[model samples]
Target: MSTTRLFNVYCDESCHLQHDGVPVMAWGAVYCQATETRAIAQAVRALKTQHGLSPAFEVKWTKVSPAKAAFYLALVDMFLADHRLRFRGLVVPDKGVLDHDRFDQSHDDWYYKMYYTMLRPIFCAPHRYRIYLDVKDTRGGPKTRKLHEVLANSLYDFDRKCIERVQQVRSHESELLPIADILIGALTYSNRGLASNSAKRAIVARLGERLGSTALTRTSTFATTKFNILLWQSREALG
Candidate 1:
């Protein structure tokens, strides 16, 4: 660790492909001071052990089921109760409406712009940051490097002192990335009107209740720190 204060940011996204057919594409991130990462992960492992899961067992939104609903709920509560952790999310309500071709931009280009936009509110300048993204594909290595370059250039972090590193790590290796998955999944699922899973609905309701909102689709209240959501609208949608 560096001598200066550092923040660790973990990010994950759902249904990001241009042709995924999913109506909503979402990105969520959780960040905290670098010193809290180990402690938070250890606490999460402890919670898993309490649920009779092996400490090494990975927690993921895909694994949320009626049988494991209690465990997932507890994890959600844990995240909300922890003041050290902060979450920021962005949702494209309808990916099909995006017109990257008309804008003379590639999907990758727009994706990076959205990524930067989602992260802008949470970033604290004059402090170092280390960002970890869930590995989506082996082919994204170049994209990951480009993300670092783009973010650094935009922030004017020439020596990369402000944004130290941005890299992809397997979700199973991270405790926070899975939380991002679960949270973003809930937002996307609700906004898509997907009511197929009762367990998911219950979790979403509980989360909304906790945030004093009936739905997680809108922007979060400014007073809220644990969960801040942004519902992205296309230029056409605005028009």
Candidate 2:
């Protein structure tokens, strides 16, 4: 690991759309020093091997099952315990409440706004970042580019210097990305009140328990590196 002072942000979203028939929308990211990424991926591969699952298997929230409860739980434990890895989630409790028309912004613009909310708190001037987003389809590339522009505008990085690059990559290609998927899935699931999968329900419960609160739908004003969740609103809360 070099002393390059580089950071990597792995971003992903869950149930993000205007009308997905789901009430909640979540965009989240996992942050770590750039140098630690390889080590983290290797550790996750080892964990998969420990569970007797293929290291190549793509881990996702839907994969949670009673048969592999221990494996998922251990993965949660690893994220919580690892000092280098940090999690931040931005959840829209009710998408129906968002009136983009009233705000005079398009849905696409709002999408970038939520992404910026999910990222702004972690940006620092001295350190540069490379943001990797999970590829969902052809739209993924365009969305990634638009997000970079919005981020640069908000950061006042006119030269596009602070944010080194924004990219789209396959989920299986990056180990830490699935972590974002799993965490965001737990968040959206808990908010949506889905309990069909007892194993997933338990895994989400473990996440809430680790963060020392059950009311994850409410924003945590003061959060540490272990787990920080910001439940955002389209409008400002009354003071």
Candidate 3:
């Protein structure tokens, strides 16, 4: 086994729930050490310098149109591969196959459910990993608070294992945002691979093959059944 270092993960997901038209997908990033974090950041900085790109993650993602977005995305993928980093992600059905809309009325709840399900597998390790999530909510907003609460609440603590921490950071300001944006954009492109002839089918196939049906089925079922029970019980109590 590779001796675990001080692993810090910078993770994000695309297609937060069942994709309305396509497949739902989530991605995880693992940095084995602080140096790796710096290296990743520096590589992104280099890209920004070479491209005259802005510093923020959101801008990097939203500023570019889809075709050019894939160009920068390929660079990010190359960087990840060169660094020997690890990535985990998932793609599953949306409403047609799994009814996330019926389960989560609020966007907050829906995203939180998806986020938790994505994090579930990584929590099994014994080592300490600091998780930094790119924040979607605006600054000084109730939505940020809700994100924090939802993240905290979703953590599963077995009697034997506890999470070191789960932090939702404001990526709007971080230089890392650009890097993360490219990563997430790539993931979005990946999950939507059902569309384009130029799409990376080999990678998508590998991900689909690794993910299998069990994780998707279990997570969807759990979210659906739990939400139904909660709704039913809430109505009962009100009555």
Q: Provide the RMSD of all predictions against the true structure, rounded to 1 decimal.
A: 2.2, 2.2, 8.9
Per-prediction tally of clashes: 0, 0, 3
lDDT of each: 0.88, 0.88, 0.48
TM-score leaderboard ranking: 1, 2, 3
Worst 10-residue stretch by lDDT in candidate 1?
213-222
lDDT of 2 by residue, 17-99 (tens): 79988889998999899999999999999999999999998999978889998999999999989999998888988898888
Residue 37 CA displacement from its true place in model 1, Å: 0.6
lDDT by residue for model 3 over 101-194, one digit each (tens)? 5665655565556555555555444555566767654543564455445555555433313444456666664445445454454455554444
TM-score for candidate 1: 0.95
TM-score per candidate, chains pooled: 0.95, 0.94, 0.56
Of the two candidates 2 and 3, the one with more favorable lDDT, higher being better, is 2
Q: In candidate 2, which residue pairs get closer than 3 Å at backbone N, Cα or C atoms, i.e. clash?
A: none
lDDT, candidate 1, 99-167, per-residue tens: 888999999999999899888777765678999999988777998899899899989889999889999
